[model samples]
Target: MADKSLSVYKYMCKYVVGTENHIKTIRLMNTFTDNLSSNNIKVTITSGSFGEGLQMVGSDLDIMLVDTTIDVHDEIKSIVFNPTQTNFALMTEDIKAGFAMLRFISSPNPAIRKICEKFKGSNYLSNALFKKSFLSELCPVLHGPCISDKSGHLDFAHCLHSKYWVTSASQWTMRSNNSWPNESTKQMIIKYGVLFVPIGSKGSNNEDLEWRMSFSVGEKFLIYTFSHTQLLVMHS
Candidate 1:
């Protein structure tokens, strides 16, 4: 990746900046639009740019459909997400259902029954990651106002923290030879932080060596964290 291309690519991918998956997502979104319209549902992206990030290799596509008629209330509640039972045959139904579904998915105070019905029943990382992106940015990129108008920025932070913990925890568990679920390379994200700081040590120590060896090959975790941190800090 050339320096100029790298800069362009960073902007290209809002979160998981990459080229391959972004194209794949665009195709998928087009397909979804065709299918939804064929079924009389009008769909459009509200926040995210399709084909702008790393695509999940073998994950389902999670999309939010909004109806054009439903009145988007100001008070955003997180207890109405329902995909299994919520029929999305038309645009109108999808908007209402999608909003409710999102609220349910991201609600700190979620409805157990609804959550279990939708999220718990599914285990697809692609759609889950897509949802995470949309919710993180609060922009739908599908239709209507972004998710930000309803919820605060906490959703984005929580999403990042969750991804980081899942990835880092997996790596830590694997090195310790512990089989506590999702060993090293799960669908979750990986983030690297300085786990060991020497106490006036001259240079790298055993701990540093071990950490470097474990993460030297792929520093995406470190890269993403630092990059995003810098951007956010500067903006703030």
Candidate 2:
């Protein structure tokens, strides 16, 4: 069975692993990263799956953006990932009715702290709308599709069909006690880099505070080093 399975893998060996495709993928990766850097986002971009030899034929090109802006004020060491802040507009007239109804209490989620839950929802909504319009303008020019793929960041049209391409932009520091980055974590950073992505989970509104952190970077290294056979098993 294993032998036959390996035989079926022949096609993958042809299309997925090769010098030409690898060069093309790397070139595109560099292009995308360079463009992103032009926006003043000081991040060291790393291709997660390709160079690692874990890329599948129809998989979206995975990219990790490590922010190098913030540093750990440990009064000791220093390190970091790319956490960017966008200027969000103030809350709307509708969300203000909350604090009283308990539906819109004063919280950071709504982005309005201290006094009330000013346009928190609106702020989030605005960010999405802004990105949509921005991608439409920038992505196509680079031949990089920013199409939505629920599983990842963007989508790609492989020889077979569509593939969800996920790109994580994060803030990973080499030195700090931010619960995620620290001295011990620096080695891992050197291996895969850092990312400050959404740090939330699936649950209730109160429990779902979608905080951002650095985790996938570590996993990238693990999968990157996994044996080719193991990687093939994952695809299986």
Candidate 3:
């Protein structure tokens, strides 16, 4: 049997985070797409821009570039993946042909890996939010096949609602509470990365800061914490 409270929470998320942030995310996606085109990337941008906030603060503008040929490594470094973890750079002519069809990988499933919903329809409102501790709002997709994988792009965009972001929020809660054992949790705290936090609308002037989490690729685990909430992810 499912817990009734969870349904309430899902409904709340759909209304507060989904309905509200979705609009702002769409606008941001359009602007980001235009910016990519101007850069001559011949790419498509999808929106992974929703969270507890309605795109007001701490929301990620995750996009994908496809349909053109470019160096996968260069594109990964310049746009898709966060490079603060390493200083590796791509070669100039690395952006050559025959690498047009590739898919962006978003990991850490929210439903099982992090949030465990005991209720039928109700789930943690933060279950599917993206961690943007080190992510900048603007991601430039430099090149690939934006045509064939259009649906895949959109699917990837919405997947954040069920995966990476939620895991991020949970990890954030775990770190703040010191729930993880020993010094391991300390190392996972994002000191030099950008993080995503959810905010609520306070009319048109203020926004309520809600759930958020931080992550780094080298930490080997995710850490996050909040009042009465704690979560952690360990690499095996």
**Going through the candidates in order, what is the number of backbone clashes in each?**
18, 17, 33
Q: Highest lDDT among the candidates is held by which one?
A: 2
Off by over 4 Å in 1: 1-41, 44-53, 75-236
Please provide, for model 1 over 1-236, each residue's C-alpha lDDT reduced to its tens digit, 9 standing for 90 to 100.
Answer: 59987665565445343344444566566557646553332333211222122343443233324332222112223334333432111111222111122212222322322322232353111212333344433443321122332323211111110112222234453444243223343223233311111011123221111111112112332222334334333323
> For residues 119-169, could you state the per-residue lDDT of candidate 2 as single tens digits?
435213211221233344324321221233454544321100001111222
Report per-prediction Cα RMSD to one decimal: 20.6, 12.0, 20.6
Looking at candidate 2, the ten consecutive residues that score lowest on lDDT are 157-166
Give the total clashing residue pairs for model 3: 33
TM-score of each: 0.20, 0.41, 0.20
Highest TM-score among the candidates is held by which one? Answer: 2
C-alpha displacement of 14 in model 1, angstroms?
18
CA lDDT of each candidate? 0.28, 0.35, 0.29
Model 3, position 155: C-alpha lDDT score: 24
